[model samples]
Target: MAEVRAEMVANVWKVVVNEGDQVSDGDTLVILESMKMEIPVISEDDGVVAQLKVAEGDVIQEGDLIAVIE
Candidate 1:
């Protein structure tokens, strides 16, 4: 399994993938808004999305768990 994490403090702007969705490396799982900028959180592994740890409008800290790929 692979864990995707937040790299900065931000509010989740959108979620692009759902649990059980197939994902490729570099696929965007969520978009984040911080300092008025939109940032995409990309998947680092190709696998099924096992968990979504965030949602739109959620405020996340740096290093927070974003998703799990299995």
Candidate 2:
């Protein structure tokens, strides 16, 4: 399993993948808003999305685990 973490502090602007979705290494999992910019959170390893720990509008800190892949 792999844990998807936030790269920086931001608000979850969108969730592009749902639980059970298959992903590739560079697949976009979520989009975050910070400093008026959108940032995409991507999977580090190919796997099925096992959990989504964040939602749209949720604020997250850097290094916070946002999703689980397995």
Candidate 3:
């Protein structure tokens, strides 16, 4: 399993994948808005999305878990 974490403090702008969705490495799972910039949070390995720890408009801090892949 892999834990996807936030790279910086930001608001979750969009969620691109949901639980049970399959994703490959580099595939964007969510988009975050930080300092007026959109940053994509990507998958590190091919796996099914086991959990989504955030939602649109939610504020997240650096190192916060964003999603879990298995």
Candidate 4:
């Protein structure tokens, strides 16, 4: 399993994948808004999304768990 974590504090602007969704490396799983910029959180490996730990409009801190892939 792989844990996808936030690299910076930001508000989750959009969730692009849901639980059980298949994703490839570099696929954007979520988009976060910070300092008026849109930052895309991407998958680091090819796998199925096992969990989603955040939602749109949620504020997340750096190192916070974003999703789990299996």
Candidate 5:
């Protein structure tokens, strides 16, 4: 299993995947807004999306666990 984590503190602007979804490397999993910039979080490995730990408008800190892929 692999964990997708926040690289910096930000507000979650969108979630682009759901549980059980098949994902590939480089798929955009979420979009976050910070300092007026839109930051896209992408999958680093091919896997099924096992869990989503945040939602739109949610605030996340650096290193926060955002999702699990397996």
Candidate 6:
């Protein structure tokens, strides 16, 4: 399993994938808003999304868990 994490502090603007959704490496699982810029939180593993740890409109910090791909 691969644990996706936030790289910086941001608000979760959108959640594009759900649990049990199939995903590939580099796919955007969620979009984050920081400093008026939208940053896509990408999945690094080619597998099913086992867990979604954040929701839209959530304020998250760096190193926060985003999702788990397995």
User: How does model 5 score by TM-score?
Assistant: 0.97
Compared with the true structure, all predictions reach lDDT values of: 0.95, 0.94, 0.97, 0.97, 0.96, 0.95
The alpha-carbon deviation from the true structure for residue 7 of candidate 5, after best TM-score superposition, in angstroms, is: 0.8
User: What are the runs in model 4 whose C-alpha is more than 4 Å off?
Assistant: none
Candidate 2: tens digits of C-alpha lDDT, residues 1-70: 9998988999999999999999999999999999999999989899999999998999999999999999
Q: Write the per-residue lDDT of candidate 3 for residues 10-58, one digit (tens) a residue.
A: 9999999999999999999999999999999999999999999998999
Residue lDDT tens for model 6, 1-70: 9998999999999999999999999999999999999999888879999999999999999999999999
Model 2 TM-score is: 0.94
Q: Which 10-residue window in model 1 sums to the lowest lDDT?
A: 1-10
- Native-referenced Cα lDDT, model 6: 0.95
Q: Going through the candidates in order, what is the number of backbone clashes in each?
A: 0, 0, 0, 0, 0, 0
The estimated TM-scores of all candidates read: 0.97, 0.94, 0.97, 0.97, 0.97, 0.97
lDDT of 5 at 45: 92
List ranges where model 3 is wrong by over 4 Å: none
What digit string (tens of lDDT, one per residue) describes model 1 on residues 1-70? 9988988999999999999999999999999999999999999899999999998999999999999999
Off by over 4 Å in 2: none
As for candidate 4, its clashing pairs are none
Give the lDDT of residue 15 in candidate 4.
98
For model 4, residues 1-70, the per-residue Cα lDDT tens digits are 9999999999999999999999999999999999999999999999999999999999999999999989
Better of 4 and 5 by lDDT: 4
Ten residues in a row with the worst lDDT in model 2? Answer: 38-47
